[model samples]
Structures are given as C-alpha cells and as structure tokens.
Target: MKPEVSIVIPSYKNSPLDLENLHKNIANLDYPQVKVKVVNIKVSEGKKRIGYAEAANKGILRNKSDLILLINADTKLDKDLLKILVGYTRKNPEVGIVGPKVYSMSDPLEVSPVDLPVLSFNKFFGKMKKVDPLWLENKRKPFSVAWISGSCMLFRRRVWKKLSGFEKNYFMYWEDADFCMRTRNLGYKVFLVPNAKIWHRSGASIGKDNPERIYYVKRNSLYFLEKYTLPPGVILNGIKTTFLIFVKTLRYFLGEKEVSKAYIRAVFDYLRRKKG
Candidate 1:
C-alpha cells in the first residue's frame, strides 16, 4: 500500500496569473493518494508572520499524513516524486529528511552541481547552466547532503515533530540548512533523492535581490552560525562571503546590469536595518 502523502504549499497573496500557473503545474502531477494543503497567509493586520516557518507550520498542522512533503509555490510537481520519496524512506527508516533533485526552470536539465565555487560563480555571473550529466546519472544511488532545497522538502511526520519544525527566527533563508543540521545532530540522515525531481523558479516568492531577501539572508546567516556553528568559523565565513559578494557586485557593475546595483542596494538596506 502507498504511504499517505500530504503536499503542503505555503503561499503569500500573489497575482492571480502566478497562482494559476502554480496550480496548473501541481495538477499536472498524476500521483494518487495525495492530499494538497494550500495555506494562504495574508500580510495585513497587526499580526506578524514569521515567514516560511509560520506558513509551513500552519500548512503542516492542517495536513493529515504520515509523510509530509513541503513544496514551494513556484515548483512544478513531478508525480513520480511522491512514490520515489516514500520508497527511499521505507528502505531507510533511519533517514529523517529527503529532498528531490531540483532544477532551475530556465535550465531544467541542469542538476545542481557538486562544486560550490562553480555554483557560486554562476550566481555571480547570472548565467544558468545545464545540469552536469554525471550528476543526473548518479541519481539512482541514494546519497547524503548537509542540506537540500526547501523547494521540494520531504520528511516523515514523526521526524518533523521531533525537530519541532523550522525555526521561526529565520524568516526566509538558511532555515532548511538549519533543519538538516538539527536532524543530523539527532542521529538521523538527510538524503537527496535524485530520482524524485522538480523544477524550481528561483526567487519566485521573493523577487531577485529584493531588499527583504537580503535582510533576512544576512540576519539569518548570523543567527544560524551563532546558534549552530562555532562562533569563530561562522564569523570568518560571514566576513569572507560578504567580501566575495562585494567583489562580484563590482564585477557585475562593469558588465552593465541593474541586478548588481540592486544587490548592493540590498546589502546597504540590510546594514541600515531596513525592514521588509
């Protein structure tokens, strides 16, 4: 029998067109025994929402399944993904979390590369490359990662309860990595299920280089490092990353694009304590 799978998508109020697109993609999935839970969080009122953590928490609370799959609103759901994920869990009961192979929509075949420097360079260059064929070829074997994309996050309900869900303090960034670390600390493995795959529209929920993204990413990096890693290493990494971003921004400026400018503006906004 198939394990009950609940797909939870947390969405903020978006243009009707975008929502239509998202609905169409998820509906395209031909998976059976799936329950879809969409949690729409409105940003009005005095209530302060704690970003993805709150939205995901709400969605999880409303779901009724032993296997909970947290999907981003901007992802194209792959029907076979559910079965693949459940199969992995069934085979490896010690595994607490699993994420499907995520491809950027612009370059669908480009499986995320193993080289951090190359991946980071691509982000700086703003060029999406096709996934390395070797990476795709290795999907048959189950492997582990320090973290996985939250775009297609899957895990057992019991494990999620044990970890107490995402940390609300991290409004938008590093929360997934933090969760992976916690799971590992508790003596569980986080695996990347390559057979299960999805395409992600990068930065769909938040526009690219949006100041809000910068603020949360910056603040959350600090929070994550402080809370989970050695202070010296975290501080050093933070400084190094900031310096590299600065250099990359300058390089982009000479190449002519407002994206670089936007990125610098965001950094300034974060430093100046700009909200949202």
Candidate 2:
C-alpha cells in the first residue's frame, strides 16, 4: 500500500534561478499520492519572531498525511525517494525520521557546499561516509544517523506528534539537530537512506554569506548549545566564535570593504538575548 506523503517546503525570497531549479526537480517526481505545501518566508518580515523553525512548523501544520517531508525551496527529489523513505519507515518500526543522501544540484553525485558545518554532528554520531569496494557494490540499507539536514528530510506524522515537533524556541540554526536528539531520547532512530537521493541548492533559504545569516547561525546555535548540552562547552565555543566576530568587526572598523558591520551586530544578538 502506498502511504500518503506531505512535502513541506519553506521558501524565502529565492532567486529566479533557484526557484526554477526547484520547480524543474519536482516536475517529474513519480509519487502517486503526494501533497506539497509551500511556506514563503521573508526575513525582513520574519524579524526573529519567526525564523526557519517557525516557517517549517507552519508548513508542517498545514500538511495532512501519514508521512511528512521537510524540504527546502532549492531541492529536487528523485522519483523513487518518497517510496523508499515511506517504505523504510513502515518496515522499520523503530525509525521515526528518514533522510536521503543529498547531493549538490550543481554536482548531483557530490556533497552540497553547506555540508561542512554539520560535519561535527555527523562525526559525533558515527555516520562518517561509508567507503568500501564490496560495500559500494551492494545496495545499501537504511542506516542510523545522529541528525539529518533540514533541506530534505521525511518523518512519520506520529513520530512528529510524539516529539511535539520542532522547538519554537529555536529561530534557525541547530533546530534539526535538536529535534533529532529529542527523537533519539524518545528511543526512535533517525535513518539515512543512501539510495534515496535529492539534489540540494546549497544555502538557498539563508544567503550563505549574508551578515544576517551569520548572525542567526551564531545566535541560534548558542541557544541550542545552552539548552541540551553542558554550559561550559557552550561558553568555551561561544568565546571562540565571539572572538572571530570581534576580529571581523575590527577589520570592518579598519575600513575593510567586504567585511560587514552587520556581522558584529549578530554577535551582540547572540550574547544578549533572553532564552526563548
């Protein structure tokens, strides 16, 4: 039996090229009973009140299906991706959330450019890329991961209901990781289906180099680190990140043309905000 699938896509003021890429990707998808819900988010209007987490939550709330997919506006799903994920979730009762191996749209078989920052979480979870000649020859099975990128992920609706969905406290960064950890604490596994694939337009939701993006990444990450992990670790990492921000600010003050003063403001936001 084919399960119902709901795809929740969050879009900002995406470039024409990015939207075109996304539309092209979904144009030929083969899923039979699928519903797509799009939530358009503009940062200027969102204003820390509703960031990615809230936008994504809005999309999720608008959906009604047994399976939920959180997708970015810049992704294209493979024809069989939903079938594989939904099947896995059904066969593996212990699995709650499932994600595909996302590749770069520019380089379909390669990792996306934004894959770096979350490498720490991947390593911590023992999901280092599989590299073996024989293993490469065989079809891979769904395997557990610490967390999956929010760009393209699928979850059981029941699992999401049980976990109470993404934390509204988080504005942007690390919400996926925090949610994954919450799922884990509830004793459900997060799976990465290597065979199920999608092409991701890197950093389409957040302008990769935008000073505002830098700010939210810093501020929301601090919130994540403080909430579930040790404070000392949070403080230590915060100090290092804060120093980097100061150095960038100093460069801007010295009349560096490209380094933005907005970057410094982000650091202040990170340091001073009350916990949400």
Cα RMSD for predicted model 2: 4.3
TM-score of each: 0.76, 0.81
lDDT of each: 0.67, 0.69
- Superposed by TM-score, candidate 1 places the C-alpha of residue 211 at a distance from the truth, in angstroms, of 1.6
Provide the clashing-pair count of each candidate structure: 2, 0
Candidate 2 has an lDDT of 0.69
Clashing pairs in model 2? none
Lowest-lDDT window of 10 residues in candidate 2?
116-125
Structure candidate 1, residue pairs in collision: 110-131, 111-131
Per-residue lDDT for 1-276 in model 1, tens only?
577677777665456666677677766666666565555543222576557776777778887788888877777767777778888898998999988877767777776342111111121222223335565545576677666767778888887789888776666766776787788788998887778888777676677577566556765655555565555665665686699677858767688345555456655655565533
Instruction: Give me the candidate number with maximum lDDT.
Output: 2
lDDT of 2 by residue, 121-232 (tens): 4322222343332342243776676677888888888878887788866666678878887888899988788788887877766667776676666667666666655656
Q: Candidate 1: where are CA atoms >4 Å away?
A: 33-47, 112-138, 238-276
